[model samples]
Target: MGGRGRAYTIVALCLALLAAGVVAGVEWARRWEGSVTLLGNWTGGDEDRFRREVLEPFEREHRIRVVYQGSSAESQVLAADVEAGTPPDVVVMPGPGELAAYAGQGRLEPLDGLFDPDHYDPMWAPEVAGAVHWVPVKADLKSMVWHPGALPEAEVARIARDPGEWCLALESGATSGWPGTDWVEDVLLQQAGWETYQKWATGRLPWTDGAVRKAWTTWGALVGAGDRQRVQRALLANYADPWGGSDPACVKERLEHQASFVRSGAHWMAVRGRYAHAKAVIPGARRDATAWEVAGDLAAMLRDTPGARALIRHLADPGTAQLGFTANRAVPTATYDADPMTGRVDATLRARGTMRCWDASDAMPPAMRDAFHQAALRFLAAPDELPQRLAVLEEMRARHRDAAWLPTVCGNG
Candidate 1:
């Protein structure tokens, strides 16, 4: 009784322990199957909107859990992760420039057959070394002038003539001067046409050239850049702030030059904002041609795991309509009809996709891009310093020779 009973009891206990271990391992495996990591620059309200409108639905439908990390320094974080061999499964970068560099280095996974490439404008999912590596998940039109309410076309032109009438907000954390860069880039695009804009943006044209020089001068005159008090305030003010300022000057700033997303700002929302084609407002835009500038957040696979592939497919769907503006033509036009402003922007994006160009600095390498931002800040502070600034920018661009620039920044002419 003692030997037989004791042996049977020990076997039963060992079997129980083994069963418990197997069950625990199976549970862990199930949890791991539904989880993926994503890195992006979307933070605060942008992050919330993405989760609410896009991510939450995907998670529910597919039963996958997304671990997202949003930060302003996402590129640096991404680089460190790659170096440490712990990169996120997916990443949504702010532009194609950074993605191009990553794809060229074999750090990114190709996105072939994940989604229909025909759904997007060719530029949004430009080829990377003969294979598509990234696609834009969100897009914003950069060439627009916003007024509190719908202003008559004639009135918009008149308001644009006066620098005092425009609202200038230069503050953007570490990227304070980017507003000016956008202005100059738009001016260049319209005045020089897409041919020259492309050449200049990709570093093929010298920064000291006449077309480039004229763009800076045009922006300075349009914004009254040298006016001391105004410059001081503009430099200090944050661009993200709502326009309903208590200051009489701010209240009187009836016009704002910003991206299409500015429609959601309190000032625009209160007044039922309207937009004018930026060309109409610019002082000396060419008579014959039209173009638009655009920017986007692009998604790329880093790990090629099952979870990452599913996230990529969800992002690439034309039916995913949460983005404020999308370049995907397959997105139902009805997706934006409830908001007239969004409707107009959606149309403009498609009509101009063949002509729309990337924000020049956004297409440049980071070193050149940051230098461009700082140069813009300097130009805003002192219009007379333009010559020196352009020279410095050219020098910096030369230094980044190894930087893999996005092959094409604009749609086919």
Candidate 2:
């Protein structure tokens, strides 16, 4: 009885201790106020990078569990969640206009105390109704023309004049035609300058105004509006298609008008190419034009719990913004500035006192924004129908005219 009973008692004691430890750990995790859900549009490499560089560190430092959901149809998914009354605690989207709409509806919590206003300018964190609703986490320089190598200014000008030499892809699935919106935005900025561009973007100017009409016609002329084959190819092509390929025809194409994110494409040409400011090659660009079009991924809070607010504060740090390349001047740039190609693009974006405007299509209300994209596609398909298309856009503009527009888009500094 002594030896056998002693061995069994020791084994039972050890098993009881282990079970007690497991119970304690589970209870601690359940009671901790350190769990938040995040919804975003990032996927693939970008999502991996954000998890590694941004979310993981925050989770470790604050002992928070971040449940992330990445989707290409982020807007639709967000809408569904909001309608179902189960929206995530935080969301990072590429469109501020949509955020503004949400904020106006009181769906977003104010970041006024959570984020340092000094870290971001008005354009990056515009306020509405006395509350800062969103902040930029990533930015890209748009309205850029990427070419394999340096081309003379004269050659660039001539290429812009010839429709056959231009390369474009309008396919982005559900967001198909947004690339076209970028072109028109760039042309408006170049030809009409920033002030006029802002007016058109913010609904102050009519879509049929002469300057706006000129921008549309100018884009049409450059992309070969009446040619079915060219338009068809553009319609079928993905935005990243021009970045790389073994096809001689694609390789020989001299110019690609796209955003800075095109640098991430797998295509050999984009990897090896450099970009110039779009104004350099834009026909009818103002001689003194210094405007640049830009876009960014923005972060906003939906549920302002202490853990969620802490996450926003972490993201607001300049160091956090610098973890990725951004157009924000407040973020450090030594890494990007070292490369000549990116440096040039970076310089243009960070230029002191120069006009830097956010992408207009991304700034308008959803209805008008969708109309702008569809209008670009329709106009490209039939240039003759432009007047009718402009009229349709005017109606959309009137419908959404009451929507809030950012007070100022171009920063003085």
Candidate 3:
């Protein structure tokens, strides 16, 4: 009697344990079925807005979970992940330049097959579709000027005539030279027009051209007769407090040229607002050609898993546009969307016409971008050595032989 009873009890206990294990495994599998991993640069408030406006809705509707990993050094993290064979399903890089590197390494999934190419603005779709590297998520106008406080019409004319008030931030860290590059592009647009801007941007035009040289001279003069030493000090000092509001360094660069994203906080500090404040800056000041210009923060897919495809779908929709614009995110756009507070300001902005996709530095290759950043620092410090600086840029461009050219959105004509 003792042997039979003990044997039956052991068998029953074993069966119960197996059943429990199977149930636990099933629940775990269910939890991860629609879940996916996303890795990229957004962090803090930006991450929160994305989760609130975009990811939460997406999860609710599709029954998917997004494991978002945010970081400041996203590119480095992405590179390391790829090397370690543990990559994310989707990534929203700052620009197409980095996307090109991933695409070349065969780390990205071609998106043309997954989404409708036409749904995106054609300007953004250019060379990105069939090539299948990246698609634009949202854009901001880069070729814009910001001024703090208020300006009288007479003052606007005065500033335009006197380049001394035209201030620029030379402390953009890994992308420091970009502010300089924006200056060069704006100068070119004012002098040579869009066609020439493209030539210089695409490297079809020589870096040593007279216009290019002139750009250096103009920018160098703006920085005053300082060598890289002085400018570097300023940049380092400026960045020491780059968290926003107002620093004498940034404020002194009075007319900071940057994307629209910084408008609210920066402008709130009364450092600057849009340059086209018709009533404030120039009562009767008319636009040169187009009323507006644009640039974008683009998202690209890293791996081609089904999870990645779902993210692509989420980002491409018009509804997702609000994610980048939420109060928490604070990334601005040049597109005319009416705000009850801003009223007809956006409408007025659109009426003037638009200049399209002219972010010069972002359009260049990654290595060249690094070179461009350092060179701008050098150029600011050594205005007289313009030729030498440009030559260096030319060499850098040559080294990145495969730097892909993205199409211009507004200035093709």
* Best candidate, TM-score: 2
Regions of candidate 1 where Cα sits further than 4 Å from its true position: 1-32, 242-249, 352-354
Indicate whether candidate 1 or candidate 2 has the larger lDDT.
Answer: 1
TM-score of each: 0.88, 0.89, 0.77
Looking at candidate 2, what is the lDDT of residue 98? 86
Please provide, for model 2 over 54-138, each residue's C-alpha lDDT reduced to its tens digit, 9 standing for 90 to 100. 9988877788889999998898999999999999999999968888889888999998787666655567787875698988877
lDDT score, candidate 3, position 159: 70
Q: How far in Å is the alpha carbon of 338 misplaced in model 3? A: 4.6
Any idea what lDDT model 3 has? Answer: 0.61
Per-residue lDDT of candidate 3, residues 159-254 (tens digit): 754445555456754566666666665666555556677777665777778877776676565445364544655556443234355435444445
Least accurate 10 contiguous residues by lDDT in model 3: 277-286
What shift in Å separates residue 325 of candidate 3 from its native position after superposition? 5.5
Candidate models: Cα lDDT each: 0.84, 0.81, 0.61
Candidate 2, residue 48: the lDDT equals 92
State the RMSD for candidate 2.
3.5
Flag regions of model 2 displaced more than 4 Å.
1-33, 243-249, 268-271, 321-323, 327-330
TM-score between candidate 3 and the true structure:
0.77
> On a 0 to 1 TM-score scale, where does candidate 2 land against the true structure?
0.89
